[model samples]
Target: MNKIIEIVSSLDTNQVYAELSHPNSGGICVFFGAVREFTNNEQVTGLEFETYEAMALKEMNKLADTALEKWGLNKVVIKHAIGKKEVQEPVVVVGASSAHRSACFEACRFLIDTLKETIPIWKKEIFKNKSVWVSAHP
Candidate 1:
């Protein structure tokens, strides 16, 4: 397959390079979304992610297909981690490989942005005393 779409409990960057590498591609672009230490000046202890698994997978597959066709990508990988994650832990990873740098660069951005806007995944920010479920967009 030209694409890999999955919702995982953990994200492994080591596998990303192999997954996005293609002989026809000159460049691969990757974006890793991680749990940050702070949000809105509040210290974030960690994060919890939840998703409608069936729908999230469907949307992710659609994104990979669209990116492949639109950018002529040789390979695509989209993954998101569920459950709890500590600060600095990767929450999601998206990548694309194309014949040149431009296509992969733009496709990588599109894949992540569109996924955040449309996918059924939700995130909760954990603080010292309380937790808040955050919207997909700010």
Candidate 2:
């Protein structure tokens, strides 16, 4: 398929390269959002992500379609993980493949930035002592 979009409990990077690889594509760009150990100097234990799956999936498909049309992308993948994620684990992955570097690069960035702005995913920062719900946009 030309597009892959899903909200998963776990993310697999091994499939990404193969998924985005196309004979006509001269360039592929990917962005991964991972959990960090600290946020604003506070020690973070992990993060929790929750989303309305149906809505999120629909929004993701829309974003992927837009990127594909706007950039003439050969392939596109948009995925996000839910539930608790430890530091260093990938929370989201966005990628694009096109005939040239610029299109894929630009599309990759647009897929991620637009996804953050439009998707209904919410994240909670897990601190050593407590958990705080951050903005839903991330």
Candidate 3:
């Protein structure tokens, strides 16, 4: 499986991870980041996400490439949602597959962690009382 980077208006975690199967890989690790119902005791109703799509897409592809080069993984998939999402909806999904579980896990972790640290997506937290722009990273 090659790197698949999708920055779209919505996301399906299952669909994102479904394509990561590889004959050479014995294990697949996946991570899904969803809109949490609470944040520091505050109730979160929804979230709005946006990005410089072109630049974000480019950065995501680079991150996927890095994960492939840095880890012993056979596949990497990274996808993120744009626009509004209700609670429990997936905001991001990442999957990595390899001959061993550890590599798959590490690659998945690195792909998401690095993406959060370096990507250009912006998020707005929608609370029951108010909404504010927040860094999509972290």
- How many steric overlaps are in each model, in order? 0, 0, 0
What 10-residue stretch in candidate 2 is worst by lDDT?
Answer: 129-138
Q: Score residue 132 of candidate 1 by CA lDDT.
A: 89
The residue-level lDDT of candidate 2 at 58 comes to 94
What is the C-alpha local distance difference test score of each model? 0.94, 0.95, 0.86
| Over 4 Å off, model 1 | 136-138
lDDT of 3 by residue, 1-138 (tens): 488889988886656546888888899999999999998899999999989999999999889888888886788888999999999899998899888898888888888898888889988999987998875257
- Provide C-alpha RMSD values for all models, in order: 1.4, 1.7, 2.1
Q: Write the per-residue lDDT of candidate 2 for residues 3-101, one digit (tens) a residue.
A: 999899999988999999999999999999999999999999999999999999999999999999999999999999999999999999999999999
Worst 10 residues of 3 by lDDT: 10-19
lDDT of 3: 0.86
Evaluate residue 29 in candidate 1 and report its C-alpha lDDT on the 0 to 100 scale.
98
- The CA lDDT at 138 in model 3 is 79
Clashing pairs in 2: none
Candidate numbers sorted by TM-score from highest down: 1, 2, 3
TM-score of each candidate structure, all chains considered together: 0.97, 0.96, 0.93
Writing each residue's lDDT as its tens digit, candidate 1 over 1-138 gives 899998999998899989998999999999999989989999999999999999999999988999999999999999999999999999999999999999999999999899989999999999999998996469
Ranking by lDDT: 2, 1, 3
